[model samples]
Target: MSDTLHPLRVSNDALDDGAELRARMADDGYVFIRRLFDPDAVLDLRREMLQVMQAGGWLAAGTDPMDGIADVSRQCTEGDPEYPQVYHEVYKLQAFHEAGHWPQILDVMGKIIDAPVLPHPQKIARLWFPKFTRHTTPVHQDFVHFQGSFDTYTCWAPVGDCPVELGGLAVAPGTHNVGAVVDHRFSLGAGQLQADAQDVPWLTTDYEPGDALLFHSLTLHKALPNLTEDRLRVSLDNRYQAADAPIAEHMLAPHLTQDAPGAITWDDVYADWTDDRLQYYWTERGGPVVPRDTSYSDRGFADALARAKRGDADARLHLERALRRDPDSDRGRQAAAALQADEAPSR
Candidate 1:
């Protein structure tokens, strides 16, 4: 890995003009908006997240929730069978759901896409534990995983201050133009694509609360490893596309499905939420649900698994489709296990 860090071109001006904003996104693949959200509000959400972890005994005893000190001895590795169950609970937090529709974030999305924005109901909360390299997200594009709209934008915001050493996001500039790259197996998560840094440099920054990184679904990005000794790196990923565009049915579902016994449910997440306005907002709006493009079907399990064994980048997607197509079959179960071994978290 190169020690050189390239800073993302910051856009501080309000993006009132749709043409200019769209041009920047098309050209750079991402636009870093500084202080788009209230930092204090972001901190409150962070505290809430840490509280959930603390209550679950995931955090170190006698430490403040904000401190995010992990009890490593009790911490679950990415490979643990119960890791997904634990992650499911964290993903269902009400704070994360609320953050998905933050007015400021939606405003930017609306302007850039030049349409009424429809934020995806399924939000992703990345809780990267310090010193746990096994769960770090690999360099990959969101398009393959979220096959709804080619114009979909993902907004990544850290819940608290995140310096480079603490594992912020790094985007391989101009990779969106190259489209999806072949994926191979990687030690952490499912797999990652090796970037040609000489052609498309990796750009990143010391992200702070309220700072958001907005990028296209095809933009290739990865999380830097959490090198800190004790603190945890918590971040949120919310996606948006034009309201008129066709959306994948799966995107409308909850972030984590109740497939397993201990899985989190929508009711559990919304139990304390007094404001019901956000509940099923998209469904009520009557957005169009289109058939999901399953292009990965072309790469069958045998070929994918064979490639996976040799660390092919597309292995995860192929396995995922298998499970989606036949979750109850013997092959489906095997696919599920393979995904688990790869530590593929729910997007």
Candidate 2:
């Protein structure tokens, strides 16, 4: 007996601007589909992905082969950000934003989730979780670094059917309105992370590929473990917005570095952002930063940023670790000084 309304499909049981589905999302805090992809599209996407893995030999969190059609494009990798698996060569592909690599994959996600978000911190990434390992994403909201309101829903669309034993996503229902954060210093990896089990009831989502499971930023979610036999799970997680909701990039700023080296112009990416339609959306959110330095290390920064956005106090420690790793960075130095000052009183 669910109390919330789900965002059900309009004409074909396929989810649209339906009231029930929206209600489900608003009340329950997540809307998951057991399966949603056409076999053909899933097959094609997998084939293309394989080509990318074969070509790049490695990939970072937001990189994919489709984005690397160009001779000198960006590619994702599992090695340290500073010294990737292949240290000498710069593999971060510039083509991710090019709109060619896995056109079908992105397009389908857009149609389903209604919000085709950029997967990369910079844009939608074709991340390759390290072999024999899975990413340990903790429970938190996606609104901070992600552009737009916290109401945004994520559609984790894996390429294959994702069963619980195969590294599915775990989420706490009816927790979307749980402020921007709570306490979680003791929480690590999976489990409640200092939260009351009764306060937030989590659902283990066992979904299939060609389909997606949606969750709000405040849903208190984490990536499930992948201990399946031989087969690995892959997915294309997209975010959706109500038709009236503005595009994500419009809300989050350009998500860019000041450097113009491999920068892709917004003018070409999409048309509307230039006229300050974007400026209006970010009235309080602020605009893209003219990164004083691009040498910022991401190792622990992603976790720290996610934690800070969720209002976790201890996230500062990871932030400090990240800054220590990025000695020659403006973002780092400022962070270092702030971290030292914050800890000064206790010492």
Candidate 3:
């Protein structure tokens, strides 16, 4: 792929009609809205998150919270037992919950999904530390992970200013039409398809607070690695779908289970909340639950894996093809493991 980055065409909220916005999403598999929420609100959440990080000894002692300066010496390597503990704390903040349900965000989601929408209760917060290449999210589609309605949309917003170098998201335009790709496991706890990104034009921009990207569930997207050695990148991933649509059972669960070490119970997270309305909102409605499509063979992934195991010269290519065809299947995971071993250096 070219080193040059292409700016995603921004949709002006005032100028774009619902039809126009929907058209943009259908064409690009995502719509980038500039200043969709209050910038100050976003920064406030950033400060709140940083305070939590500071308490966890993840931030530099003297730096301003808004700066998000990481304590390099104190950084915990990936898979460290304490790492998930810190993430669990970040997930429990009131600010985090409030931001996920911000009114403006829901309004936009309503327009896009064209129905009553319920934002998934389990929100994801990404904290990207500088120079941590393994921490960068790999290129993957969200549909496999979230097997709810195919119409589900993910709204990603930076909690603070995210320059391109700060590792904002980059998406391959119109990749949703390609359907689910076979995905291999990567660092950063997400699956990555091994297909060359050069096959599609990638779009990204310097994201300011309030700017948000709403993408289709199957869109191919990835995070740009944080290049700055001192700064931290913080962002939110919140999903929304039509209320009548069947949803995966896991989407309603808390982000960190109570069983996980250092996880706070949902009861404790809601204890001080003044608004009782937000609690158990989805369950009270009794929405339909749907089983996620976890089968990968319908896309011929099994055949591809069989060919690869036969010592085919194009084994890697076959695996990539399998992933592109049915990323949600069990075969996709097997294909990923085979590809990982293929890439590993010999002893």
Candidate 4:
């Protein structure tokens, strides 16, 4: 893909017309709305999230949390041993989860879906650090990560103003029209699976605090690298689907609960929350639960193992992290064997 990014078409004018909104979504595979949220409310959530990061030693000492100045030395991504320690703290914020269910978000999603919307219980936040481009989220469809239905939609919004250099999301127009999930391969980036975008043109913008980009589960998209010198890029990417649609079982748990040592349960996340309003709210309203398909990740891990044996640095690094994260698990043992095989002398 070229370094150039085309501007996203703004769909704010269609807010009142569900037909127009769904038509745009059908034609473009996405709807980008500016100021869909109150900027002040976004900034307030940014402060709350960043304050947690600051307390966890992610931000530069003495800097205001709202500034989001990273310390750099403390940088870690989703799979790293050190990441979930701080990430789960930010995850614990009541406001962080509430942002997913904001009425504006629900109304917009309801319009686009033309049905009652159910926000997935696994709310997500991307707390990215500067200069960590290798681990930037790769190009992929949401279905591979967030399965159960192709009708699912993802709403991504930056907590603060996000310029291009701070790693906001970009989507390939009309990619969802392909109608099915594309083949995905292992990647070192967030979600770990990457799709083949080939030559598709991508669209994005220097996102403001309240801007939202909503797209289909099959739409191709990726995060632009966070190229800033000393700042952190924080954003939210939450999933929604019709209230009656089937949802994967795993989507009901807290995000990153599968990661070891740093993993946290919903109770752990809710222990410090100020209210019970949103807690377990999905129990009554959640869609029909289906078993999560592990094929995507299983294939990705197999690819990583093969690449690691060939001395691919990124793949080897992924294997090493897996080994370190959990030495006794089946995949961890596979990773250890791959790394060991890679180091063996020639026959």
User: Which structure among the candidates has the greatest TM-score?
Assistant: 4
Q: How would you encode candidate 4's per-residue C-alpha lDDT over 193-303 as one tens digit per residue?
A: 999988898899999999999999999999999999999999999999999999999999998886575478889989988889999988997458999999999999999
**Candidate 3 global Cα RMSD:** 6.8
User: What TM-score would every model get versus the actual structure?
Assistant: 0.82, 0.55, 0.80, 0.98
Query: Rank by lDDT, descending?
Result: 4, 3, 1, 2
Number of the top candidate by lDDT?
Answer: 4
Candidate 4 clashing pairs, residues 3+ apart or interchain: none
lDDT scores in order: 0.74, 0.45, 0.75, 0.93
lDDT by residue for model 3 (217-253), tens: 8888888878888888899999999888889876777
Q: Order of candidates by TM-score, top first? A: 4, 1, 3, 2
- Residue pairs with colliding backbones in model 1 are 183-312, 183-313, 183-314, 184-311, 184-312, 184-313, 185-311
Higher lDDT: candidate 3 or 4? Answer: 4
What CA root-mean-square deviation does each model show from the true structure? 5.9, 9.8, 6.8, 1.4
Model 2 lDDT at residue 82: 29
Off by over 4 Å in 2: 1-17, 59-79, 82-135, 179-199, 228-232, 242-325, 331-347
Q: Between candidates 1 and 2, name the one with more favorable TM-score.
A: 1
